[model samples]
Structures are given as structure tokens and as C-alpha cells.
Target: MKKILLLSACLSIIPGTTLAQNTTAGTIELDMPGHFQRQSVSFDYVRRDVMIPMRDGVKLHTVILVPKDARNAPILMTRTPYNADHMTSFASSGDMSSVLEGYDNMTDVIADGGYIRVVQDVRGKYRSEGRYVMNRPFRGPLNGTQVDHATDTWDTIEWLVHNTPESNGKVGIIGISYDGFTALTALFHPHPALKVSVPMNPMVDGWIGDDWFHNGAFREENLPYIYDQDATPKNDEKWWSNHYDAYDLYLNAVSAGALGKSRGMEQIGFFRQITAHLAYDSWWQNQAMDKLLVKEGLTVPTLLVHSLWDQEDSYGAVATWYALENVPTSARNLSIVIGPWNHGGERVEASKLGDIKFRADTGYYFRKKILEPFLAHYLKDSTISLPARVSEFRTGENIWETASKLPAPDCASECKALHLEPGHGLGFTIPGVDAGAAQYTSDPDHPVPYVPRPVLTKGVTGSPWKYWLVTDQRDVASRPDVLTFTSEILTKPLTIEGEPLVHLTASTTGTDGDFVVKLIDVFPDQVSAQPEMGGYQLMVSADILRGRYRKSFEHPEAIPANTPQLYKIALPFTNHTFLPGHKIMVQIQSSWFPLYDRNPQSYVDNIFFAPKAAYKPATISVDIRNSWIDLHTK
Candidate 1:
């Protein structure tokens, strides 16, 4: 009875969200009922695990879902190392079964609207046969640097189309995060059966710069947490033990002062071992998929989805979009959707925000309108058409806006440069209007707490901006090492589209330093905040650039104390229309504690090996003459 009420409530709620565009050329709207009851829809499915043969003779574990009534249905395939069994559990839940039971493991809201779903474990994880290698090659011996997971994906698609009954020889792939990477790899081969794909937050590049690593700086906090949760262990005992280890590590790491000292020392030890290889050496470069995708080319239509606030794999989505856009294939299609939500927050936030109510129907519109038409047209050859572009949901406005392309930079006037004068706070000098220089001390022993706690290590976690929305940095602004800069509130709405580059001319007293730059939208009012609802400010976008590998990711050089250097760091690109009332704020600080590992002031061979005594405060200077962030304005 409770399940029935839940279904009824889901249907009764009207989606107030707006669409990106009002008119899509050939779009066909299906008469979807207001609410779908789980009991009303029924389908027979069989879950059988089979070994999918790869080129290297190692078979990957795969699970297939077939509708009992269908004799011939096109296959919807997904390759994921995050366990197909988890997907099965997700499907077994109430409304999800309506979509999951009929299709392959891929989640299609149109299940009542037909398709076979196929899900396979990647080469090394889960029930897959091969020994799991973390983002390693899918074929050849473990030693080869040239192999990739794409080949393994290509092989799986070929086998599924041939082996699965009622498969119309047409296949579409979809998945989020790493699973998205697998879907994208399958497209590199462009098998005849591969017709469509949706790679959401796919890992297009492997070097720490893209997803796992950021600017060669180990996202130490997120790394251990994700590794502890997602990476498959050598066996069941190991997996279960590691799960407990993760909890122990989390408790120790977050216990105020016991950060570097804890029970899960082995987990932190493992983190140090992996992060020590920071260069874009063989280990990191081999996993990047963009270059390989371009070289092989994609033969299928694709849709790319990412969250503007995506904490885990932000770089992959935008990078892959640009990479695939240049491929010389007519059938190649690229569409992107980004929203102001965390990695997994989009699906769950439908109704209330804390006690405040901003009614939202999370996935219903996407499932019924966008996803349904896309799959129907590609897999079933349905007459449903689609818009050229679609972006739905914005937080403040609580509505959707449609645009042909993402907002463009507001670069109408000459590019202006603001200097970070040693003692002057961040702002354009009004002749003699010297706002006393901003300062804050970044102590490795006592660093600024990164909001929304990073995954596990001591580094910036997923979206610290969310937490910064409420916490005023004004207190930190008075410190000796933190730098705060702000641009005068725009007289007009400033629309910035594309990437922003930060050019800095500075010198550090230490051998290594981290420059964390955040682009924020300062709200009009301040409010008391909570863990979930950090008040007032809305973080549009933020990014961190490691100083050591500024010139080249593969090598690092010590900064001679007091010697000036030129460093140009690429801050994360953002698509936002900064309203006239909002102020643009950029915060530069050397240490974002526990969110990022502390950099010892001394020039050390490896951070992991640096002795605890080496950690100390270092004085740094920023010359604003050559330091400024170039914002692309429309």
C-alpha cells in the first residue's frame, strides 16, 4: 500500500522545470500517463551470467535482460565495473523495475514505451574473469601500455548482438561515470550494431588531470574513499575486509586532529603509493581515451551528460564533447546537458530543500521527454524526433532555459588585467582606491577546512563550492596566506562561456605550492547554513591547479625562494550568466586541508616521503602585473 502511494504521489506531481528549447525539429511526444504504477506493468526477465570473450582470450562477466514476450528487440548495452548486480538491485526496486525488467540492464524510462538490456562487468572488476587492473588495458598482458578497455567493449557488443535472442542487430549503449567510459569506448570501434550511446560523466582522460588526478595533485581525499568503495578486491574476503577498512579510515581521517595518524594507516599508505607516481608518465597517460577516440573515430550518434557541480569526474564530460565533435563522421552526434547539482544529487532532489519547498520532479521529465525519444528513434526506428540541444533545470530560477549553444563569453570589451599587488586585496585599483591587501595564513598543520568533506584524503572534495555558499571567507581573508580578489559587481549581466585562464607572476618561499582558484557568484544576503544547505552564495564553478607541474605535467622543478616565475593555470571553464546583482569573487589559497594533501615548504623528492618535521609555513608573494584571470565574456 505504501508503494502504491509512492507511485501515485510521483504521478500527481507536475514537472515545473522548463526545456532548453521550445521547438525541436522532428521531436515526437508520446502520450505518457501522469504516473506509472509498478504493479500495472509486468515483464518476465532472465538473469544469466556468461563469459564475454575478449581479444586476449580472457572472458568478461556479462548479464543479459530479455523481455519474455519479445521475439526480436534491439539491445541496449552497458559496460560497467561497478557491478551489474548493483544495477539489478536498483532495477528490482518499485518504479525502476517497470523500466529495467523489459530492457537490458540499461535504464530506459521507456520500458513500457520496448528493448533488451545488456550489462557486462569490465575486464577485471566484479564477476568479470580477468584479473582486475585499475583502469588498465582490456587486452594483452598486464605489461602493455598501448592497450585500452575500448577493445574489450567492442568485443562484448559483437558477442551480445550475435548471441542474444531477438536482438535486431542494433545496439545502443549508456552508463554514468566509468560505465560511461565503457560506452564511449565501444563507439570507438563503430560496430555495425552500435547505433546510439549516452556517456554521462565518462572518463575520457586518465591522467590525474582529467578525473582521477587534478593538475598532478593527488585528490588525496577522494582517491582513497573511491578506491575503498569501488575498486574490486583480490577476492571476497579482501573485499569485505576493505569495506571495513574504509570505515576505519574515514573515522580516523575526519577525527579532527588525528588526520595523519589513524587505524586505517594501510589505506593511507596505499594512497601514498599510488599518488607518488604523479607525473603524466606511462601509468597516467595510458588511460586517456580522447586521442584514441579521435584516431579510431565514432560511427554512432551520441549524447553526453554532465553536472556543472559534478565533484568526481568533471573533466571527462566536457573534454570528450570537444574531442568527439571534431570526428569526421556524419552519423556522429553530440549533445551536452549540465546542471547545478552534485554527482548523484540530480536524481534524488525532487521536492523539499531542507524545510523549504521548491518542488522538483527529478528524473521524470528527462526519462519521459528526452531519453525516451532518443532511444525510440535510434533503437526502434520510431518517428520520435529531438531538439538539437536540451538543458533543463537551474537552481535559483527553478526553471529550465533553452539555448542553441552554451552561453558565450562576455568578451565585448578589451581584456582587462588586475594585478595581485603584494598588499592590495583582489580588485581593480581605482587610482588610489587601495583596499588593503587581502591575507590569510595556510598552515599545513592547521589548514582551512574544505567544505562538503572530500572523499577520504586531505584534499578538495567533490564540490566545496556548495559549502562555501554559506561560510563566509571574510574571516579567512584576514589571515596571512589566503588571497581574496573580487571584481566590482557588473553593471550589466555578464555571460561567461568557455574556459578561463589564470596568469600569475609570483614566487614562493617553498619548493612546491598549490594555487586553488574558485569562481563564485556572491549572493545578496547571508544566512545560517547547514551541512546540506550552505546558505546564500551559489558556487557556479571552481578548479585547482598544482604549481609544481605548471610548465609540464611529466616533470617538476623546485621554485627558488624569492625568484619570480610566470605561471598560467587553466581554471575550470563554466557556462553561466552572472546576473547584474551578483558579484564575481575569486579566492586563492595555497592549502585546502584534508581536501588536498599539505605541501611541505621544503623541496622534497616525493611528498609521501617528506618527513613530518618538514611541514612548515612559507611566505609567498604574488605580483599582479602579469597575474589575472582572463574571463571570456559575451
Candidate 2:
């Protein structure tokens, strides 16, 4: 009792504290109030937390930050499944830079330009009240409800323009990854106030080439993402790993479906959906954002940002640009900026990714020179004009190039074919002799590791998944199962500005398989500038295709055993130049394991549920005479 009284007296004497006392049966309880307010320092911005009501009566949690001197300021909003509160409170300090540190906030423009900054939790995320659906489909066949991201965005924009008196009634939407998908949705039925949209590294088509799957081969690394994202409403469920090495964990599990069951991921709705639809079906085709955008057309001024080394969603931005470019409206309203960065790397200092260096802070340059100016022109009516339709940061050359057009018509018309010759050589001319085959046995038990092993699970701290795209390919080149073909040292620079097509005529001993193709840039044997990068084999573009989907993505069929079949794969866009003293290389292999799920040599109804018996060794033979890579050159 005396100790409590003494503590209360001490707290009461403190200049900035107060004490309250309550007595029960001669025992006194004292409560000392701690200062909850900042002292001496004043925040330059004001933050308001509100529940913005959607069209369907669901209120989304939103955080709005307005500059103190703001008047008739434009609004910038990002709709995200990621928690709004956590993203808004980036730092303990009141400084705007300290608060909006990452993602698509554009800290410099928001803090200095005096624009109203807003971030909101999508339906059923964080404090938002509603049931969550992974990548909620538009309000039609997929979704029976009237509300979707498009409608929700419409409602939010309508409320923001009308309710927030500090704004000039102009709005822009920007986000990366999944949030980027929401930004794209805003273009469907944009509010009167919504003017511009910037979707960086958006998830355009999960089935064809993004996040969940690349072509028909499932990206096994994303299984944990589904577990974490869809297992609970708050995304509080963490993906737990029982093994130190992901290689053994995935291999030992036998199949992705079995792995999910072992990890208790069956409850996750997305996992269930993924397992159910092993082949590209109406469900996935209908949800493809790029195709949807094509139907909707470009309704607003949109800027698509792509990263050359983006480990995730590398196909989305470029694919979306390709889909909408031919549309008359899009030609005027759509522009794209490609950079040498990783997924969502534009938000951070991006001078380098893994062993590759761009010779400049590419992220900063994109934000300030291209992104900021574009946003300013639309939102703030700034006098600065927008850049060309396409702004690309060319690697190897280490310079930014602008063009009024892309998928350069001349580049495609003058495309060059690099042929795979006998004795593992790469050249532009067709081989004189027909090499029988480059044969290798692909064993599921010893599937080639995507990266050097001690392969840690993705999403863990220090995991190399983020920059794996830029990691050296030399590690896998030595594997016997992987066929390596290299060209002589280049005396002149070779620039490829568009998608490189892989034409393969290969045969598998078994009924099913996967082909992994890589276009690599082999550095000089001795790099004078960076010793660590000497002889480094950097993958310029790569993708995998399941043999079953070679004929059609929607249909699956067994490969005729030991029969050569033509497989054409379109590698992702590469605006890279192979400089003098460097060599061009091509690597072909089966099973980039743990990154992509192991393809059971024997065909099954569903690969996800393939049993242990399905795993087998299969001999793969590539016909060097027929195999060639068509490059879209500048």
C-alpha cells in the first residue's frame, strides 16, 4: 500500500504525468498516466483514419495523410490487401518519408509535392469488414455479387473527391504486385476524379506467366504464399517449414497436393483451387487481367512499369502493354517503363540486383524522371510533358533509351534466328550437319536445383528468391541433365529488344516432361572491373513449359513416348545488349526443381496429386538441327 502511494506521488510530481486512485477495503490502486502525445516536434502532415464504405455496404479501412498547407491538392491512392495501418505507419517519426517508406507511395512526391496520400485495405483484409477472395473476380460469371475491386474503387474515389475538402478532386491510383492488380481494376470503371494509374509488376495472368504458374509448370515456391494469404482473414498464419533445405522438403513430399496436405494447406481456398485446376481452364482464363483489360480497353491514362529482373510477375506489365497497345484508345493513353530491377524494386535503391549492376540507381531515375513527371502531368496538371510511349533501361549497355513505339515493327520483321549446332555451339547460321540428338537422363529423384543448394524456403529472411533471376547460371550449367550451348566471344554488341521465341524439337522417353529454356549472357573470363562477376553466366530470359500443354494450354495430353514433338516457347521480353568480349549462351534442361514442381515422367490425371510411383527417370533428346531461338533484334 505504501509502495503504491509512493509510486503515485512520484508519478504525480512528474511534469507531464497524472495519477488516479481507487480504494477498496483499505487497499489503494493507483493509475499513472503516461504521455501519449509528441513533445516539442510538430508533424508537417495530418493523418486521418476512416472506414470508407464500399458500394455493397462493406467499409474498408483507410489511412489518409494530408500536408498541413495542402489546398486543392491532388489525391494519390493505393488499394492493397496488405494491411493499411502497418503500411501507413512505416516509422515512429512524423516525417512523411519516415512514414511512407516503401511500396508505391512515392515518398518524395508525396512529402515535397503536397499531394494527399491515401492507402486502404481491400475487402476482408485487416480492419475491413467482408469475406476475402483471392484476386476477387469481376462482378459477372466469376463473382455473383455486384461488388468487386472495380466497384469498390469507384466508391472509394467517389467518396474521396466529395468528402476530402483539401483535394483538387483529381485522383491517381498506383501499386505494385497484387495491389497493382487493384490499380488496374480502377481503369475498368474509373470515377470522374480518377485520372491516372500506374501498375508496377502487376499480376496479369497467373496461369500463363505470373506468380502461381509460368506457362503450364506450376511455381512451387508460391504454395506457401497461398497458405499464408488465404489461410486466414488477417493473413496471420505463417508458413512453417520443417526442413532447412526446401529441395529435400519438396522432393520428399512427392507431389504439390501431397505437400499441401502434409502442411495442412488443404483448408486454404486458393490451394484447393490451384490443385483442382491443373490445366488452364475457363476459371483462370477468365481472370487473366491482361485479357480483361483488353476487353475494357484503356479508359484512363495508364503507365505500366516493368522490371527486367523481376522474379515475380515479370510477364504482367509487358504482357498488359502488348495486349492493349493495338487498341486505338490505348495508343494515346498507355505508356510503359521497363527498368533493371527486381520485383517491386522501383520503390527502393536499385543500383544492383544480385551479381548484376545497372551502373546507376535505376529505381530513383525511373521514379524521378519518368514516374513522377507522368503522375504530375495528369494529377497536378504540371507543365512537364510525359516521356515517350516506351522508356527502357537497357542492361549491358547500362543506359536508358526512349522510343515512341515498342515491339518495334522493324525489329520483328528483321528478327534473327540463333540455331543450336552440333557439339554444343550457338550461332546465327544453320548447322551444316544434322546432329542426331543431345541426350540426357532427367531423374525426378535428382532434379536439377534452380539455384545452388542448401536451398532455403522462400519468404524467409535472407532468402535469395527476390534476386534469383539475376543469380549466376554457372551453378546449373555443369549438370549433365542440362545441355549447354555457347557462342564465340562477341566482337560487336548484339541487342535483343523484344521477346525471344524458343523453337524446340525434343523427345522424352516417358509420357510427360517439362522443358526449361534459358537465354544467358556469359561475361568475359576475366572482368577487370568486378572480379566476382568474371565468367558469370547471367540468364537474360527463361521460362518452362509442361509437355502436356505443348499443343494447347486448356487441354492436357500424354506425349507419345520417344517421339519428337515441336515445342515453341515465347521467353519474356529482354531489352539487353550482349556487349563485345561477352558470349551468348543457351541452356536447356528438365526440372528446375523446388522453383517449379517436379513433372512426373509418367502422365497422370493431375500432377498435383501424382503419387510416389509416378516419379521416374526419363531420357530427353533434343534435335539440334531443328532447334533454334528466334530473337527480336533492334
Candidate 3:
């Protein structure tokens, strides 16, 4: 009976009086319903809850918020897996900002622009009726089903433009993360009323670089998400950690698969898919949104928003931009805005990340200057001009740059090379003397923590993982198992506008291992402006790759023990400058524990099922003579 009540509470079953018997009256009375109908309240906007019918006769839960004086206003919509009711209800007052503070409403932009805001629960989520698939593949080779997110979005937009009498018949879709993925799908066969799309930090390709995996390494920290999100449609289930420190918890769990099994994740469909397709098989390839978008062609003006320090989906926005760069339609219709922010940070406060400060409220500026104008121009017929095809925030210089000054993606070919030379040094020219190798012992038993000790689970809101990308690198640089290569203080500013490629010829005593390379900017010893940040080691770009997948991401081959081989790790996109008096440094290590699963140094057929005994110590050596980094300069 207790379990039944708990389940009832979780499902939000209405409460009232239980069935009763009146023996004396010799008559029966029905259960009385709750008194919810008597409560009345007023809001600033007219809120309407409707279940819009899809092509397949499925009704998706949607909430529309229209301003009291709305007249022919454009509709700005976001279709989300996250519940629409919780996202749309923040206050009972007449202020739009108060009603939409938590979700990625871009409140000021919507409130001031007088746009009708619509939030909907995607099919199979919340109150929507259907089966839910994680990052549901398009209706093609991967998906044999007739209806997908694209079709659902089309049906929703069609309903909005026709049913909403106040709408001007122009619509724009905007969202972040999973919601962003849905927004990107709307561009597949865009409706005539769909005018523009803003996919902010979207999850494009899970196999290549996105939320699921990077290169060939799985993001084990995200396992909790799979449990919470896929356990049920309403997502009422929760994942609890036995240990407070994530490092200890993951270490004790032995392997991610074992941990997941202990948590009953084997029942989740998405978890099963993740385990079944560990490699970048056709399952992952066919669903890549970036590739799908290119194949379908860009039909609407799309603006991609990228965050320089985005902790999640960092590669999606930039990767999508590159994939669409050469497409004829993209040249004029695609625009990108890159800023210094965490995942979806552009929608909230963004003046600073971690210990670093940008000296201004960058989020407010972006919404007012970039997002608002872009929406108004395309959706409201405003004369405000949009930024260039590429608009990125230069970090150290702390200013925005448009396409006029943006350099090519691989301009490092023209700039001088930054080589990893002997005696822990980085120089413009290669070292003439032979430096044998830089060696370090990698022990899976005591792997390097991605962040400082006492690391908490990242699934919780406001966790340090949100800004862990910008955390000081000094913590790991001091460890003996890590290698640090530094350059002399810069006499002039060093600017880089694109990706940084790490090239290394390395060998390990075991057949498998992992390599993590970080490009960082070392602040000066003394700073006049901020004393706390003096000598801070800030990571500019970094990434990791599993050694077994060196030749190809889809295939796994064990490394020849003690034999030197070449490894190229491509870091994420960045637009930053190492100012004068600052130093440029690179750090290399084998593991980024708890964040990514430990690479059982020894060879294994499948890492997900690797045994505890398979994880052993290995000696990793980097041949300085053959190793160097190629930096794309401005």
C-alpha cells in the first residue's frame, strides 16, 4: 500500500476522498474530487495549455504564452524533452521575465520583442504520447519509423501558425542542448512559416564530438543522465551515488558497465544501445545531425551559437558550422556566434567563468545585440543587420570579432610551428639536439582526476562540472605522472583563431591507453588588475583520444607494445590570445578520471566489459623529436 502511494505521488495522481459506504442512509456516494477548480489566479500573459495533434494522431503537450496586448506577434517556439509545464511556469505575476526565468527563454529578448512564446514536450516525453528515442535518428536508414522529430516539429509549427490567431504567421525555433537538437531538426524540411533557427550548443554527432563520446573515449560521467532521462517518460526516477566524491565512487565501481548494472540501468533502452554500439558504427554515423543537415540542405537562415568553454556539446556547434561551411546554401544562410560560456551559458549570466572575468555582462550584450536583432530581422521584418558569418569572442583580448577579421580554419599552415622540444620547453623552431623521450608511468589504479579532489557528480544542477573547463590547470600540472612543456613569456600577443592539433609519436608498455593534451595560457607572476589570478594556468583548448582507435574511430586495434606510433589529437575550436608577459604551456597525461572512464592500459576486446584485473600499470613515452603541436593563428 505504501509503495502504491509512492508511485501514485510520483505520477501525480489527483487526491480526493476515498470511496465510502453510508450504511444508515442505505445509499452510496461517489468519491469527491479535489477542490483545484475553486482556485483562480491572474498572470501577465494569457497562458493556454493544448495537446496539439501530430501527423500520426499523437497529441503533444504544448504551452503557449501570449502577451496581453499581443497583435500579430511572431511565435518563438522550443520543443523540449524536458517538461514544458515546469519550464514555462516560474511565477504567477504579470511579468514575463518572472514566468520564464529558469528555462532558456532569453526572457529579456522575448518580453521586449513581444513574441508569443511556445514550449512543447517532445513526443514520448512528459505528457506527450508516444515512444521516446534518445537523439532519435531521422526517418531513414537508422529509423524505419514514419514519424520523427522533423515531422513532429513541422506538425507543431503548422498548428501554431494556423491556430494561434495573434501570431503573424512567422515562426522561429530556438533551444539549447537536447532542445537545440530538436530545433536543428526543424530545418530538415522547414515549413514556409519557419523563418529562422537558433540552435544554441546543439548535440550534433554523439559518436564524434558531443555529449556521448569524444574521439573513441566514452563520457562515463554522463551515465546518470541516461538513468534519469530514460528510466521513464516523465523522468521522475533519480540516480543516487553511494559515495560523495565522484572520484572514489567511480574508482570503486570498477567499470562503467558494472556500475550501470548495479543501478538497474540494463533495463533502460538507451543504455542498452550505448553498450551494444560501443564503437562508431552505422548506428551512430547515420544519426549525426550535422551530416543529416548537410544532406537535407539548409533551407532557412540558421544561426549557430557556440560557447568557447562549453562543458557539454562543445564540438557540436563548431562541427556543424564546418560541415555546412562549403554548402552553397550555407554561405548566405548560416551564421555562427561563439562566446566564452559554459553549456547554454549565453541564456543566463556570462560575464565570468570560474576565476576569469570578461569585465562586462557578456550574456546581456549577446541577447540584446546579437540574438534580439537576428530574431527581429528575420521574424519581425526589422532593419537591424546581423553579424558576419562568424562572430567569435576573443578571450584574452575580451572583444567580439566578425567575419571581416576572422581567419581560415587552418591558418596554422602559414604561421610558425610551436614544437615540443627538449627540457620541457616549447619553441618556434625545432630543437637541433636529439631528445630521446619523455616518459611517465600510467596506473589505472590511481588515475588522474579530471578536476580537483572531492569531485561531485556532474548530473546535479549547479555542480562544479558546469565550469570545470575553465578550472585552473595548475592542479594537475603539479602531478609527477603529468608532463608539462612551457614556452618563454611572450613579448607580444599570440592570437589563435581555430582548432589546435596535437601530434605525438608515443609508445606504451601495454597494448591500450589514453592520451590527454591541454593547451593553456600561463598568466604573469604579478598582475596589476587582479592579484588572485596571477600565475593562473587557464586551459585554452584540450582533448583526449583512446590509443586503440588511432587508425580509425570505427575500428579498434591494439597498440604494438613498446613500439613508437603516431597519435594526433584535435582539440576543440577556440578564438583567444595569449597576451604579452603571459606564457603558453602544454600538459599531457594518460587519464581524466570520473569524467571519462579509465582506459584499462592493457588491451581489451570491449572496454565496457573489461574486468578489474585488466586494468594495470603501463609506461607511456612521448618522443619529443617527433612530437609537436600545430596551432591555427590569426
- Cα lDDT tens digits, model 3, 1-634, are 9999897676664454332334445566656776545232455688899999999899999999998878989999999999999888887666777788776689989887899999999989999999999999889887898899999999999999989999999999999999999989999988999999999999998877799888888899999898889999999999898888889988999998888999999999888888888788899989888888888889899999999898889889888888887887765788889999989999987889888899888888789988998999999867888767777789999998778333455644565578888899998888766777999999999999988988877866556898899988898999989999999999999998788888888999999999999999999998889998889999999989999888888888999999999998878988899999999999999999888999998998888879999999999999998888888776
| Top candidate, metric TM-score | 2
State the lDDT of candidate 1 residue by residue for 234-293, as single tens digits: 323221223222334423343212342333333433344454566777655555676656
Whole-model lDDT, candidate 1? 0.60
Worst 10 residues of 3 by lDDT: 15-24
Q: What is the C-alpha RMSD of each candidate to the true structure, in Å?
A: 14.0, 3.2, 7.0
Better of 1 and 3 by TM-score: 3
lDDT of each: 0.60, 0.89, 0.88
Give residue 327's lDDT in candidate 3 (0 to 100). 82
What range of 10 consecutive residues in model 2 has the weakest lDDT sum?
16-25
lDDT score, candidate 3:
0.88
Which lDDT tens digits does candidate 2 get at residues 215-258?
A: 88999988888888888878899888888899999998998889
| 2 or 3, greater by TM-score | 2
Off by over 4 Å in 3: 1-42, 404-412, 459-462
Per-prediction TM-score to the true structure, in the order listed: 0.77, 0.95, 0.93
Which scores better on lDDT, 2 or 3? 2
